[model samples]
Target: MTVSPAPREHDVLTDLLTQVGYRNEKAFAELYRRTSARLFGLCMRMMGDPDDAEETLQECFVVVWHRAPLFDPRLAGAMTWLMAIARNKAIDRLRQRPRTQGARDIDWDALPDTSPGPAEDGENDLAYRRLSDCLGALENRQRYCVRDAFFSGLTYVELAERMQVPLGTMKSWIRRALQQLRACMTP
Candidate 1:
């Protein structure tokens, strides 16, 4: 009679992975054999395309191979981390497209300015009002760093440049800002 390996076998595989270099295609293939079908199904459902899903599956496995060393068993289940990586890869592939800019320039006034309706504007304005009010409660420098990072999408380097502050100072300010924001937002 044939005997199957216990669930502990998979746990042993994960533990061994950190020590085994990523060059071990056999180990990678073993992991893939276990997980690919579920990941492929998830990709197909999210992307609605079989070919793209297959491509994403391959890309996800590539990342898994490279990042195996970084995986932490204590933080989350192995399957959860693997699935999250697969989902992110599939989403990235689905969203990737060429950005085309036409060379011909037309008069700006000729274009229809279909701005957001008054209702949407009012909703956005109210949300901004609430955010600004909450932000006003923060220390002045903390608020500035938070606003620049959140609203302007500026990185620490960019914020440091704009604020004429050191990068480490900007990082510290933003870190403190986020801690305070979370505290304020929480009950």
Candidate 2:
């Protein structure tokens, strides 16, 4: 299960977001620092390409900076508001892409066997469950960074930017998380 932030954390984000509505650059920076990782994860999932995700994240923040005043705390939390913007931005980017870019001739009948045998299916299920439990053992931010880097295929530099951490810090987090996962799964 994912952990939700404490009320105090929510209040701080809310405060920063409110300040951002008033054109406070410092507040915006803090807000970005606190939220960018998760938002970038969402963008990566939606955009399916690191460059597109990065561009979408940038566009989302631009919209957030301009439309912060439109946020209604009664309706949603600050993160929710930001996520909506990121999601919309990702969708817009998807819509703007050339449809023909992904089009290709396919010989469907010549494709290799894609379905796993019973033994393989069982093994895959066990591995997935183990991986899920191991990932759950990680710190929330570290888990997010690992997922974004490995599952979304984002590079270290992209992960660092999304997480708003130094590249070294991002590398350390991923390394430690992987070590922990390995340890957990070894037995």
Candidate 3:
């Protein structure tokens, strides 16, 4: 059996990001070329509408252009950091729209899958199974809080109030649940 080598910390993408920090137009263009489709797709899934997704995607790139100098490779990969920025932007946009009192709940099935992973189909299935197992290991309340807060786009305050717990306790439940998930999922 052949085991793959552990992933490296640095990559060409981060190297290009360093160049972008110096206001290198070429590097920025290259970075966009390499990453735009995936991030745009992420925006699509998170926003659940193409028009809004496109606008959010544009906003994300503007952020990249201005914040390139602040990119730190030690905490996360360049692409990972960019992806988080796009996600947070989408979430912020989601939270900005007015909620209807009698509106129906969000249809999770309609959302596209934004997760990235191995190129192989088998590996993708394995990773998902592992993730499901890790999620299943959590207490019911913790699982609900984590899933609801992320997919339902509910604020922690709302979740806490719904569950009849203090805000800090709600945060702690999610945080510890996340820690358990990380431990279970990590090799």
Best by TM-score: 3
Clashing pairs in 2: none
Candidates ranked, most accurate by lDDT first: 3, 2, 1
TM-scores for all predictions: 0.46, 0.51, 0.67
Candidate 3 achieves a global lDDT of: 0.76
Q: Could you tell me which residue pairs clash in candidate 1?
A: none
Alpha-carbon shift of residue 105 in model 3 (angstroms): 6.0
Clashing pairs in 3: none
Ranking according to TM-score, highest score first? 3, 2, 1
Model 2 lDDT tens row, 69-98: 888788776776887788777767765777
lDDT of 3 by residue, 1-187 (tens): 9998854323667877888999999989987877778788777766778998899989998998899899988877776688788988887888887764211244444555544431123234555579878988899889878876764467888788778999999999999999999999899
Clashes (N, CA, C under 3 Å) per candidate: 0, 0, 0
lDDT of 2 at 78: 75
Q: State the TM-score for model 3.
A: 0.67
**Which runs in model 2 stand beyond 4 Å of their true positions?**
1-7, 101-187
Error of 3 at 123 (Å): 7.3
Residue 30 local lDDT, model 1 = 69
Q: Candidate 3 at residue 81, lDDT? A: 80
